[model samples]
Target chain A: MAVKLFYEALHDGLEEEMQRNKDVLVIGEDVGHYGGSYKVTKGLHEQFGDLRVLDTPICENSFTGMAIGAAMVGLRPVIEGMNMGFLLLAFNQIANNAGMLRYTSGGQFKIPIVIRGPGGVGRQLGAEHSQRLEGYFNNVPGLKIVHTSTVYNAKGLLKSAIRDDNPVLFFEHVLLYNLKEEIPDEEYYVPLDKADVVRSGKDITILTYGRMRYHCLDAVKTLVANDIDPEVIDLISLKPLDMETIVASVKKTHRVIIVEEDMKSGGIGAEVAASIIEQCFDYLDAPVIRLAGKDVPVPYNGRMEETVIPYPKDIVRAVEDMLALRV
Target chain B: MVQEQLAPTKYDPIDRQEALMLYRDIVLGRTFEDMCAQMYYRGKMFGFVHLYNGQEAVSTGFIKQLRPDDYVTSTYRDHVHALSKGVPPRAVMAELFGKATGCSKGRGGSMHLFSAEHNLLGGFAFIGEGIPIALGAAFAAKYRGTDQVSVCFFGDGTTNNGQFFECLNMAVLWKLPILFVVENNLWSIGMQHHRASSVTDIYRKADAFDMPGYLVDGMDTLECRQAAIKAIKRARAGEGPTLLECSTYRFRGHSLADPDELRDPKEKEFWRKQDPIPKLTKFIQEQGLASAAELKLIEQEIRAEVEDAVQFGEDSPEPPVDELYRFQFAEDE
Candidate 1:
């Protein structure tokens, strides 16, 4: 195993996928000479040449639509959004074309394309740059939503996303790029539809993914000191959500707290909470609670950005409050 | 003399066999669309069914020249383009009928015809959205080091769409093998071209991308064919994309729902006189390319062929309800 940063893992995944399949390619703004805004595609241009590592103009809709077309013609194009937030401009292309093209084309085309980039609140990227787009793209059909938190899973999940025949929206948390972990030297793949049970406990299940998973784990430390053992489950796949793991956790713990950086209204947490209630209503000892991002736009101020999204303290309070009901 | 040389059949732009093939497709398009009008009126087809009536020349002129493998992306008014690109009329008709045997398996109705085998990308209902897709196909051709070209067809109104300009700029920048065939049918549904766009001259927009652009007589099949053939040659030779604005007109309303009173009767009469089908026939007779008897025989054959397509559509089964979720995700074959 070799130690690597989160962004390096993603880069390795892309490089390895491209190396394995000549048909796999990279396209986005500044991905060629500039090495990508986040450097996730660094050195790919030199290794794969300009055609394979394409640098497109700042036409998100056009490039995204074009990538969908290339995927239709049998090329596996992994389009990186310079910032995942900026790709909202191509939301129509993603929804109507990339997501629906396979179905709309009557199974004639398999849109084996990956749309991945950095997202979530980060150092106050303002409202536009800082966004949790998982909420926006979650409802789009024929798409798999992956949120990678660690270095190991980032590489494996990203490689899996690249190979997935369906269009995948891989959301990388901007804050977690520096986080490091040891990944196996040999090839590995994490299934797109599975959840990772980070920590096991008999108490409430703290369901979270992406950057929020770390926040929840941090809260788990305080919970552990307080003699409250909480199960932590990282929801890796946001769409085609890992319901089996969630159901098992819910059945075991009988209580749930969903933490996410996206908004409270119509958020992924809301969907997960509703689904848990639907599936395991009888098993639950207490009502499920959600700690999600505010409804308002992510503010530019660092302190204000922290207020909008969940903090470790929020998760701790949620765990304490839910456990207090049983007491 | 220059005008005479540019006219159809005057100098035999195509040989006898090619002429017959081109004429057959044009006839097929015209007949198929006429049947569509009948089907729509009879309540056999639903939704916005845009028929390509007067613009048969534009579809035939460009797509008839393409190899079966060459990609073609069309607008909502796309039945003819699909037919010209070699999508069987029966399948096109079946799609309109929303049948299982349709090109898109009845998942896509009239406006969204798709045939992967024919390389007909799809008929996008949204203006200019189809351009980028066609650009991708061209990009794939170039990336794969093939001489294959991608042809995108849309209307005059779609020129104002952001995707149109975005795709044009990128196509030139990437030096992709693509042909942007704008069928200037003089209107965008109810909006007249001059009123909708700042540049009334649509082909001039191509100059913004530094790509070669041609303005062709869309009603004249020979002129449209010549411009398209030259553009295809440039694309296949790796000379990059070219834009051709074919000034055609749609004889029918934008959709079946539109009342036929938006345009001036005088202007309608003028375009009616320039109807491409009759023009081709007259040219053929004048140049002795085919005699009247031969032309009549071809028309009769196309008429029967169109009737057969309608029968196929009528006889085809509706998509099974149990398999409603089948095509959502592709399974391992």
Candidate 2:
């Protein structure tokens, strides 16, 4: 076992993949020479050379399209966007091009590509830099969306994402990178599209991912102290959601609470909640509840932004409200 | 001083069979566009339909010269490109009909036609986006040591995009086996090329990228074929990429919805007078490639083919409502 931070795990995973496969290359702005924006790709360019670790011009759409093209031509490209917020500029290529190529080609082509970057609010990075776009991407089809909340899962899931014959949008929360966990030393992979039962219980189901996964875990502890056993499901992959696990858990508990760091309206939580009601309506004891960020621009202030986004206390309060409704 | 190795090929004597195939492709492309125009008017299709009514020679001439196993990538004005690559007209019509039998299972309409069998990468809707993709395909061809070349087709407007220059630089620098074909029609949407571009001559733009460039009369099918054959041969032989500027015109507006009044009435009449079909028909007749009766029979055959395609599209089933969420993953779990 190895104790490593989430960022370190990502670095190790990328290094291992690059060494393992000559076709695996990393390209992005400031990823080469200057290291990564967060120094995650530090010393990569020197080891791998400029051909593999590329420094692209500030054209996000071009680089994104180039990455797709590279992937189409039998290269596994790990494209890094400086921040997830910048992914908006490349949305056309990601949504229209990368997302459609595999199916449009009738499975003759596969884009084994990984587009990764930091997501969610961190300090006072303001509106553009700190926005959570998981929900925006969740609306797009033909993409596997993954959010790594733990160091172990980050390495395991990223390795799987690189090896998978699909385009994956790997969301690394800016706040969770420094957080540490013990990861196995041996090579392993955690399959995408399946949710992890982070903390299991029976009284209620708390579905969440990314930084909010930890927050939900904290909330579950509080709920336990108040004599409630809240089951926490970490949704690693958001698009091809393991509806089986969600519906099965919902059927057992009969109550659901979704926590997301993104806005309440049109959030991924809304989709999951809607899916639960549509697929397992008869099994529900109560309406599926969602504890998401308030529908507003993310604030720049540290404390105000923290309050606006979903917190452990928010999840606990929502669970308490749901329990009262059941009574 | 011109380098002998980089010079354009002299005109060659083409066989009668090759002549008929070229003529057939031009007619097929025109018929496909004509059907798309009528379908859009009848509300049988939705979204932007960029008809290639007056630009048949460019798609026909270029694609006919390439091997079926070679690849092609292009922009939104691509119903003709799809037809030229031998995508079933019925399948294209079904796509326009948004039916399950369509090329992309009705997920992608008019601008996004993709035929993997013929190595037609896709008709990417975004301008200049397909160039690098084509280059990458060509790169793969080179890497695998295949006798395949990838041709990228785009309109005059795409030259103004940043990716155009970037792709040109990379494709030329790396000696990627690709051909960049510019269907330089006078207008892009509503703006004239002269008004939109810093330098209106597209071939000169190719020169700046350190690659050989050629200017062809896009209205003349023979001229287009002559230029394209050389460029395609160059790319396939690993001689590096070439840029061909096919100066063409579009008889219709950019899309079915575009009420184009931007151009002079005289300019529109001038290009329409040089319609590719009539030009090719004259060549075929002047050279005695086919008799007048044979030409009439060909026209009848094409009309019948087009009508059958439209019927196939109309009779095809619409994509099931549940399939709206289909293809989200490779397999539905």
Worst 10 residues of 2 chain A by lDDT: A101-110
Pairs with backbone N, CA or C atoms under 3 Å apart (clashes), candidate 2: none
Query: On residues B1-333, what C-alpha lDDT tens digit does candidate 2 reach at each position?
Result: 122232333556777788788888888888878888888889999989889899999988889888888888878888889888888888888888888788767877888888777777888888888887887677566655777888999999999998788778767766778888999997988888999998998888877877888888888888888888888888878889888888999999989889887878999998889998988889888888887788788778888898998999999988788656655554542
DockQ of 2: 0.31
Q: What Cα-based lDDT does every candidate model obtain? A: 0.90, 0.84
lDDT of 1 by residue, A123-216 (tens): 9679998898998999998888999989999999999999999899999989898998888999999998899999999998999999999899
* The best candidate in terms of lDDT: 1
Q: Which of the numbered candidates is closest to the native, going by highest TM-score?
A: 1
Candidate 1 chain A worst ten-residue window by lDDT? A98-107
Tell me the deviation in Å of residue A44 in model 2.
5.6
For residue A280, model 2's alpha carbon misses the true position, in angstroms, by 5.5
